[model samples]
Target chain A: MNPTLGMYRPRNTPMHQAPAWFKAVLLVVIAAVFVLFTDPITSVGLMAACVLLLISTGPPLKATAQGLLGIVIIAALSGGFHVWRGEIDRAIDLAADLVGLVALALAVTSSTPMEHMLDLVSRILRPLRRVIPPETMGLMFAITVRAVPEVARMMSESRSAAKARGLDRSFRAVLIPTTTRTVGFALDLGQALHARGIAEEGDNPAPYRRARRVKH
Target chain B: MIEFLDAEFTAPDSGARILEPTTLTLDERRISIIGANGSGKSTLARMINGLATPTSGSVRVDGMDTVKQGAKVRRVVGFLFTEPSSQLIMPTAIEDITLSLRRSIKDRTEREAAAMQILGDIGLADKADVSVNALSGGQRQMLALAGVLAITPRIIVADEPTTLLDLRWRAHVGALLRSLPLQVIEITHDLEAAARAQRTIVVDHGAVVFDGDPAEAVEYYRALMLDRAVGEPAT
Candidate 1:
């Protein structure tokens, strides 16, 4: 079966037992640190740390490699560009940073339940209710994350559809339907939300000033 | 009760009337709408909860105006669409139900508990944390229905809810839908299901052609289709 996006994989690791919010915040801090670092030796250290962290989560290493395949390819191409520019050390550093960042992200995602993560986010954003509804934003964030897989599926399907009729050479025919279907999906999604009466945020901007204190 | 007071609907794109002016008072616990594709039955059903607002008139649910009190009206009416995928927006089943309960239950712990109870009611407690994309079609549809029912809406408006399921799943889904305690307004192609409703409505060419007992209404619709079949020249 295809791996679920940002879904919890029931594991009894220490990371799995860690608070979802803590892991979420930690991932962001880790990403920022990786972005700031520049040296290959330091980045290699970071990559080793991330690998140890990922190993603690106890998922199969082969599965991790498969999940990180895209990251590997991109990192290779990016690192190769640095080497082509006569910066071999820089190439290794860049690849290490990329790989470390993605590994940490995957580790965090696999450890925490997505809903727990989103709920914590919603609570943290509650004070900004006057500017925007925190709950709605949380829902949007989850939807956006889930949409990545949906969009990916659509892309593969579009390629196969184009190849079926030997219209693979025609970008117009393939791109048009892919783009059109994405828009259609949005429209259908909007209608579905409306039907479910979950369009509460967009219709009412910010009336949080008048909101009464309710028990959480 | 859901009431349509001379409601009319015009297609925004075509600028043509899809639902002619119609007046109805729906108080039945179970009412089914039967019609051919694009025959305005969905347009009528949507008006109840303000999914499709009346172009010229008004729709009221238990005296609450659907347009003026759109949000409030929506709180009372839950909708189930033909395609379940659109309804399962969250990655996992529990999360989707939790989303439904966000308005009602503010506490995250309480909301999760409530969602779990709803899932258990729908026989999906074991699959709570499982991604919805991984579920079978019948399970997905059941989860979608569970999401709607989680909020405890007063009425459920299902537009061809079983159209996408295979025979067994279709029967299973239809039975599950019929067994709901709340008032249900279903628009469907299944005459057998339609036959079980307290009342049935028939729409044709964007208008209500028949409304009465389920047996008579289904008979009228079948006869109308048969007549059209014989009257029209073979292609």
Candidate 2:
């Protein structure tokens, strides 16, 4: 199980089977509730509910904790700021609300498969098909999701290369290679897209083909 | 059939020849191309699918001009890159396959079912939901092939598809590629794999230096490499 944030985890649960639109609406409603009710007790209770929901999905506890580390750092910083201004109760409320929202988001993403999200994006963009192709946009979103780990890997490689030359502390050394590699990767991806014949008008636009050819 | 009618490529910026004037007809079931680094072998393979257009002459697949009918030619020809990560655009194996079938299969359920069937055929059924990043290099290459096969391409043009795989995986993928019914034009540094092809082509310094029997072509390529290693200047 990778500890990357917002990555889908395979599971068998109601949340996993739920449709993308439904989960999105539920997320918005829950988020609204959290914002509307600012009391520390209510926020903490909501956060607990979110955590339980996440646990029910059966993801590894350690991975989940690691995935939430970024949010934790931000929450701590905000809380520290409030505490320095002598608003202890406000800090607790704010931190709890932030944690609850992120946990709920993680629960939704971990349960929902990327296909569902892509389908939902296609449906949402269908209305704007005249200006932008829905299929192309959906594919773009998928590629963006795929590029996350690749960019991270490239960044790690750049850091190592810099360290080898004793330039690890220099931002320019890391930034230059990472940026160049990312651009090259993008060029490769563009060629792949072209080779795949995506967003091309050559293929027939038939809604359904009666024949499904076997794999070559 | 793929035809290169005096096809040639030149660097747009430097105006240097990448592939010299070449006239060739490719109809073999398996064709292997071998060359040194920057020898324009990749440029030749890319032209088959219109990824790299010739500056002067024309390349055609089944009589369809690559420049004018590139998209249609791409449907007939599927390309595989050396690095599978660049080609696998979707987050998961099944999703990537489904994306490949998007134009062919319209119904979502049917597309997904077809994707699953392809995954199963490729021995990746259990890993369908697994993230692409988590898969081993060989598995990712297999997934990329699955995506290419989902489109049912008549011709598969692979540019060093197995160069990144380990020895065992290279053999596995090589055997799998050989088993395909479609015409396969592969660019390889692996002489043994090239020797297994029906025909072999040796490219050097923007020209087809040799094209004939597989074993003979391999010998020619080896000799060419030796000459270069001994500090021979370009002809």
Candidate 3:
């Protein structure tokens, strides 16, 4: 599966130009509809529509298919489980529903930049600004998204380090280093955030004030 | 100008000295700090931007107290880390730079354009939308620098920024840092790079053991290392 499947791919398609909040709402509504519909043919048709929508976003079809491989495996396993229970029609509907939902979700994610999503989130949560700063939540979301590949890289590095030391078979050997590295990464990230003046904007600069005006 | 007015740092829990009391005014366009590991070089550099506050005396950048005016100080100072991955908070190059401009540029399209412009200047224009994970170590460091530059800071404090890079990337990043039109205080183990600075300070045992010409500071640090090696028992 493609590690970068959900990450925005630069494109000039209509999907890319659509507002992030609109796509988010559409994704939610479509997901709800997919769950409500139990017919195999309808589910398969919806899955095809999702696939078409994803293709229209202009990302490489081969790469997109590769990214959906893990989902396909999960859907197949689920279908097999349902078939074992003597529910052939239910198996097809469930498998199609899973694939369709994942595709639609990917369509939204691949076309929308993370910053736009954060902006949408900040607007949604702006009312709760007193209790929880939307900017802090946005930072948390960005960091969590950023850490996905980093954790994957660290895990591989830890595994390699274990293998080099002839401890490849030991799960503890790999886990320890990976966990330590993750904690260290988090600390460094916090320090970087501090250095960048994030969460410390008491006396906002002229450009910042002007920018806030522009944003509003 | 950055001033360390008899500033000192002590471990909060252990009450051990991390940086000994010292006073220095730094106004040079390029100043390098060199020291052994755990010798308080990072502590000194970090204080300039208020990442680490002094335990007793105060540190000021252009007369703004680092502790009291931390946010203001941070605005004037941009910091670069040894590990670029740590500094990068976004998945893509353009997005990371845009994140840096989040405060300064409110308009989304204009901010993205500004980020793209920075990427082009840094020769990462083609990789603007590429995932940062796909970048080379050198390119990642360059992107990290781009993120720092997005704020248009007056001073930059880099703590071992090139220590993680290969020889080629090290030279590239070192040259880039030198060419930047701002005050730079770098903490590095690279004696050659240290010598390129206008002035150099040597830290040892949590004290500024030597502060003068870059060449002389390097020589003093080398001699100090040799002296320590000769005096210590062999492991």
Most accurate candidate by TM-score? 1
Better of 2 and 3 by DockQ: 3
lDDT of 3 by residue, A110-190 (tens): 899988987887787777765566777877887887897788889998999999999979999999999999999999999
Error of 2 at B196 (Å): 1.5
Model 3: per-residue Cα lDDT over B1-235, one tens digit each: 9999999999888999999998999999999999999999999999999989999899999999998778789999999999898898888999999988988899999999999999999899999989998899999999999999898999999999999999999999999999999999999999999999999999999999999999999999999999988999878
| Deviation from native of the Cα of residue A126 in model 3, angstroms | 2.4
Fraction of native A-B contacts kept, per candidate: 0.52, 0.69, 0.76
Candidate 1, B157-225: lDDT as tens digits: 999999999998898888898898999999999999999999999999999999999999999999998
What shift in Å separates residue B183 of candidate 3 from its native position after superposition? Answer: 0.9
Instruction: Evaluate residue A143 in candidate 3 and report its C-alpha lDDT on the 0 to 100 scale.
Output: 82
Off by over 4 Å in 2: A1-4, A31-45, A86-94, A202-216, B232-235
For candidate 1, what is the interface RMSD?
5.2
Query: Candidate 2, residue A116: CA error in Å?
Result: 1.5
Which scores greater on DockQ, model 1 or model 2?
Answer: 2
What is the CAPRI rating of model 1's predicted complex?
A: acceptable
Write one digit per residue (lDDT tens) for candidate 1, span A1-216: 134633567799999999987888888887777778877788899988987887788766775777778788999999999999999988998899888988887788778766776778677887786787776777787777667766666667788899998988888777888888787777777777776777363333447423521221
Q: Please compute DockQ, using alpha carbons, for every candidate against the native two-chain complex.
A: 0.42, 0.44, 0.47
